[model samples]
Target: MTITINTSEIPDTATEADRALKAKHAAMWASGDYPAVATDIVAALGGVLVDTLDIRAGHCVLDVAAGTGTSALPAARRGAVVTATDLTPELLDLGRASAAEHGLQLSWQVADAEALPYDDGAFDAVMSAIGVMFAPHHQQAADELLRVCRPGGRIGVLSWTPAGFIGQMFAVLKPYAPPPPPGASPAPLWGSGDHVRQLFGERVTDFVARERSLPVTRFADGAEFRDYFKRNYGPTIAVYRFIAGDPDKVAALDAELAALGDRFLAEGVMHWDYLLVTATRA
Candidate 1:
């Protein structure tokens, strides 16, 4: 079955709703120490993008919704002129410090993926590593990625699949969380080639997608993994905190997530499956 979403049909009330949603998203991300959680595998993810896109010296690259310089720092280290943007100032601060430690220069800014602050065709390549997918307005975010990329320039994306570990975890937590507002697209859709193609529409060419596994080994065991995410992961923390008043609901969610972790665990390690998307501006 095909589902069509008409963003234009949004009522005037949606403006305030969108603002509220954005605020919540920013606050949720800022609530926990995301760098602690993302630091381990971010470089690996960035390396994949660098290799896949053949990011080389002198190419201008933009990393949207960048959290703690995941892809930006690596691209800079490879001699590319990189600019990183994110909605959270804390993440940017962490990213800046990380870049300084590596003695790499990168332009960092506080910007939203839905409304990028860059000019048209301002970059040779645009990418987001498990970022941008969380933007409530998926179409707008996709448009901005395409807009800032020069014609023929490459656009790369990494996102968790709906059938992947992270996706399943979110599903397990959904019952305890508040429902998403109308017209808000689920972030995992970005991991689907069909959804991505529909979002990019006719504005892109040579679209390609590949599935890959990212190792997640922050915790020693399933129980530890559950505790770590509840304490440190943004969305996980947010959901637990939101339902804190209901002990029963919180416990249920915790149990479900722990079970999910156990299901995905193998040899004391967990693997998250993600989609790597590559396309050229038409």
Candidate 2:
């Protein structure tokens, strides 16, 4: 049985500003060729997460904030019934097309990480791969992640650590980016084991955490890495967009990003640190 949610109804209390911000968020992600970014870089991270969850055939899986089915496709390949949800429909369209090409059967839906529409305990396993951490409301998103998971079901998440290359990149971009919404937590906080424990609290058990590195060799040097992200990554693009009118600020951000990449690059590879967390819904 394929379970799905109807997303036609927006919350009654959603303010105009809230709608506008969500529109902007959707635009930022849709602005880039993120599917290429996923395919070219970080492709291995998804399979690693699926293995951690021990997803099996016939398991009902939900991939929240799934970007082009990074983890969803892998789960489907294992013969699990998969539902891949993301806030951006453009990305979902590409993911659907990719799945069609591979003969992988999975449902794709547009869904917000903070307000998932499914019934309680709808999935046997719930996961996200560097996806849910970007939601503006951390606690709400975390609650939704746990809510949809069946009791004793597996839950897994993989995110970039605060001290890692991607996290440092966010730090470098923070100065130039616009202020986040009220109560919005920094995305890198999801990578902290301590922070996640606080969020999940006693609602989950059998907790396990691992810090690992994903070696990237896609870019030959720091400048290339910066350029690629500027063209492809939404957050990086948003930062550059914020300072577009000032040549001086633009140049400064450019140099900073290049330098950050160079600092991480070693022996023709850059090691990106990430946190992998797994637990059972109590």
Query: How big is the positional error of residue 201 in model 1, measured in Å on the Cα after superposition?
Result: 1.4
lDDT computed for candidate 1: 0.85
Cα-lDDT of candidate 2: 0.91
Backbone clashes counted, model 2: 0
Q: To one decimal, what is the Cα RMSD in angstroms of model 2 from the true structure?
A: 1.5
Cα-based lDDT for every prediction: 0.85, 0.91
lDDT of 2 by residue, 1-282 (tens): 779584455354556776677788888999878887999999988798799999999999999999899999999999999999999999999999999999999999898888887888999999999999998888888998999999999999999999999999999999899998887899999999999988999999999889999999998989999999999999889888888999999999999999999999999999999999999999
Instruction: List where candidate 1 sits over 4 angstroms from the true fold.
Output: 1-14
Best-fitting candidate, scored by TM-score: 2
